[model samples]
Target: MYNSNYYIPDLVEIQRQGFFNLLEKGIVEEISKRNPITCFEKQIEIFFYPEYYRLTKPFYSIQQAIFYKKSYVSKLYVPVQITDRKTKRVFLKWMLLAHFPLMTNRGHFLLNGSARVIINQLVRSPGIYFRENMHEIYSNKWSEKPSTSFRRFYADIICLKGTWLRIECDKDFSMWAKMKKGPKIPLLWFLLGMGLSEKYILNSVHKPMNLLESFTKEIEKNQRAKTFKELKYPYVSTSKKAWEQIQKLFKLKKTLRKSSSKNTFETKKSSIVSSSFTFFIQKRTEEKYNKNNETKSKKRIKNVQKGDPKQNSEKKIGSQLEAHELGRKWFSNKFMNPRTYDLGKQGRWSINKKLGLTIPIEQTTLTALDVLMATDSLMKIEDGFLEIDDIDHLKNKRVRTAGEALQEILSVGLIRLEKSIRLKLNGNTKQTFIQKNSFFNFHALISTRPMNGAFREFFGTHPLSQFMDQINPLAEITHKRRLSSLGPGGVSRDTATLAIRGIHPSHYGRICPIETPEGKNTGLVNSITTYAKISVQGFLESPFHKVYKGQVQKTLGVFFLAPDKEEHFQTATPDLRLTSLGFLPKNPIPVRIGKRFVRMRSHKLALMGVSPLQMISVATSFIPFLEHDDANRALMGSNMQRQAVPLIRPERPFIGTGLEARVVSDSGHAVLSKTSGYVIYSSGSKIYLYTF
Candidate 1:
């Protein structure tokens, strides 16, 4: 019977939070003491008594929370925020609760606990439940790759009312959740849950059918009471054999714990004394961290330049969260697939390889294309002007032995037709035309069927286009941007100018200088700021830059970037600081910008709104229609006609996708056909030999 009663669920939720707080506190102490890095060697907790992981809790009142089932536990998860203890403490308190942790093991304790060894083995096995996890949460703010931990952890977790919550290093949260007579929802809580499901269940890790009993047995077996029945340390009094057994047990622990257990306590008083001493040590460690933070803030006032505004701006640059994860292969497959990719990127790569250049979207391909486009269609073209069927002459042939090429190129695609009339004027006609308009431009001779499909989809008139549809991300870019000072400054003679330069427009002069006991601190100022935006058809890159865009019909990836350049407010947590991009000898190089910003593409004719997938369609449709400027052309063939192909970068780069491309000049330009409902490339570089 589900208890519509007291707070068992709340207690369970709160207990998890409390445990996280304690764990973080412990980690902070470890850092403060300059302890080596530590991590939890997790174990599948075994319930010794009630046959449930939840039953391991020593508190008798836990029964109050188990209304769902006294004997049944569908599943349990150990949602570890694989982050530093400090971050785990400050930002992720809510995460510890809401979901379930089969057990919360301390990283340091795992170094010696036998619990650590067994847990590692269990994780490798499929017997336990580990489901939809908030993977890869970074405690340090910046994370690169899909972290095994979770961030925005609060979004997925749900806590019942009346829960007792605890954070890392926190003793416990006894705050009354009794909602006072007030508005229906607290503004903060309401906002947090806004646009969210009315109710969200935990991303439950389903217990395996065969291993459910085994996992349950393990958790039930390992449940230890709050009081570990005092096993005499060393058990020396028993015999040499007893000592050997104790030594063996110690040996089984993680290296750190194995070394730590060298000393055995002889009495209860010693144990009590050790616990008390550990608490004080922990307290002292906390104080040290606080003092360090204070020192850092103070140092900023001292080290900043006496009076350099630009340098001041540099100092004003605060910390941010630029945690980009390692590239996902699926994301890369969007553009690259040498065997099955658009030759666009492959051509560029080939060029790069030939040039011995490491540029992402090889520049050589673009160069070759430019040259081809620049040349007149006099030589490469075989006829005076090419029609739809003429351009279809070339295509990928399934040549078992290079003899079946005709079957491939002659496939039914865009058809040829006459839409315009071209007249040849001789004496009488020339006289009439010359008298009427003095030009021979009125009569069109030929026409062609209209183009459609991915072409329309590319030109952006098609439905079910790859990007035009909405793709809600699992997590949003959290708005945590804060205005803070990171760089240290010293008192400058020209303090006024220095402070002005140091002020970032974000703060709106909220920061100012004060004549402190040590020196003069930079003061803030007030000034209205605006970004001069250009309505462009292009892609958005980082916070400050935009790439070229073709006519866009769809939105790509998580960030919605337009070909039109615009700068909105960058959103992030106020606590996080901005990090500059780091360059490495090899790429895809590790890079970072504002957390809210992503690099996108913009083309001359199209933009990012037209999905990258649609690009090929556009290029294919208008391949014959596009004319090469006289200046750049390298795609020229012996017939004096150019080919159609835009340059591209590798499918996946070190940082992001969408690299530069080159356009080759050809006789044909691709466009929509009025008669036909498909895209066709009309070649202009048709070859015609003049008989003089």
Candidate 2:
């Protein structure tokens, strides 16, 4: 059965490339078209009165700021420039210490009234990987012997830009298979059975002629054989060699067993005798004397004590012999149970069981032989021992690509196949499914769903306004913007803690050393340096030069160039000229030498080669002072400080308190005073200024 859980869809179709592009593009367009000051005002207004919440008709209150012991006019009125009809003039406007929207050094925005900051997530590079797994085959009820052990090997080719393909095969050499979201089949026969030319198969490999010839020979041999059993048998020479190897392995195993058994027997016998003496020392000494006397009496009665003593001694000797025999039998039974004794007889089989051996000894040896035969067949095919015309079944199958061959193998293994679909905004469209029997549609499914709900909610929407409503409810909008470190396949909370538990060299240039949370997430979740950039290619470029002066030399350097310029080998000179082929070495050169490189000692460089770009100059890319501040802490400060209220005293003290307070009129107007002793105090009914 096809496992949907393991099935991963194409990354290209599912990634929110467009969404990220639109966000950045919209901000740039807004900046270019609108006046900075006017835009700031409009943003502030909208932030305080978000359209989504305003539409719900909720009650609103005017927020105010107070100035203590100062005239309202002096503190509130500030000079501002006003542009009217292309003429600029100075004007006095009522200005308070009201919070305004501020754009952070990072590409995030703060809502003036809400005191929230929005942070964009970091995107990671994608790549392909080969995953290894083991499969178990259970025994059939009818067969008394164990089930045939099978090892399944597979590779997952995840093309970040294209579709994903899974290629698999069993160790049995029966067939090779491929899968995307379905079962497997015999790759070779499936391709040939689909009527694809041998040329196609040859092209799939680095050396086509060898594969074709070997494949042809196997087919020809199978055709000559009358039964499956005959086809399964190896050549006389190969079988003889394999048999000899097996016999040698068996003999070696036997010798090792005999040596081990002798050692164990000696140790166990000594231990048993020593243990018996501890429990029956007195009885054992008496039995020995009795045995000697009995032997002496058998030859001469006079040797034994005369009279009743002689009879009693004889009876005691007989009882002692019986007791000794019983003890010996009891000790033997206790120490050597039937199961334990049988284990020694089982020998290698018992060892194999402990080692979790899946394949039988003989079958394992035969499998190795089969592998050699398969290799030999490929060699013969490469050497041109067989021709395409010799195989009659080639006319029936038409497998085209390596992927198709894999799919065919899976089909033969009785795996089910299904069609995958792609969901489009316009409508739901059906992706064409490849027929197992046909060779035309061999490519795997090419679409995948969004990895998670957060991805969909964040990237799927258009305008920022629309996203704000979903994240912050209209009924109870929060002033705080939630920033999450988690993203698609990103370092989770647990993983983040693990990364910070121990220091690593790779973290030196990538993670911020000073900037981390002081809370539960301390050191675990951290910010990357401003200059740090993740490579789309999934590999970091190290800064090193192959040639310097007259001799080939390596130097630590990081080159910062435009992506396009870097691709064309253009140096970041005044004119931005491309370097000549002769002057440029075959290997990549560093873009720029960072401060870290300058500080590095010559011995350090010689000992441990230069570090990769990701390992240097991390602080350059982030905000100067804010980079070290914890994100959670910053958020808490922003929200908490906004709600802070100043403390005021009702009575003035004899010593000057050096504290000033502002009184506001009941009509929401600031009452400013020049008197130093004037203090603004608030009561239940009215705000009052008391002079002491």
Candidate whose lDDT is highest:
2
Model 1 per-residue lDDT tens digits across residues 93-164: 111111111222111011111111000000010000101213354556665654454311000111111111
Across 522-627, the per-residue lDDT of candidate 2 in tens digits comes to: 5433444323333322122222233233122323333432121223321111111224431323333333232122332122222111222223122111122343
Cα lDDT of model 1 overall? 0.21
RMSD, every candidate, angstroms: 38.4, 32.4
* TM-score for candidate 2: 0.27
TM-score for all models, in order of appearance: 0.13, 0.27
Our model 2 lands, by Cα RMSD against the true structure, at 32.4
Report lDDT (CA) for all predictions: 0.21, 0.29
TM-score for candidate 1, residues paired by index: 0.13
lDDT of 1 at 159: 16
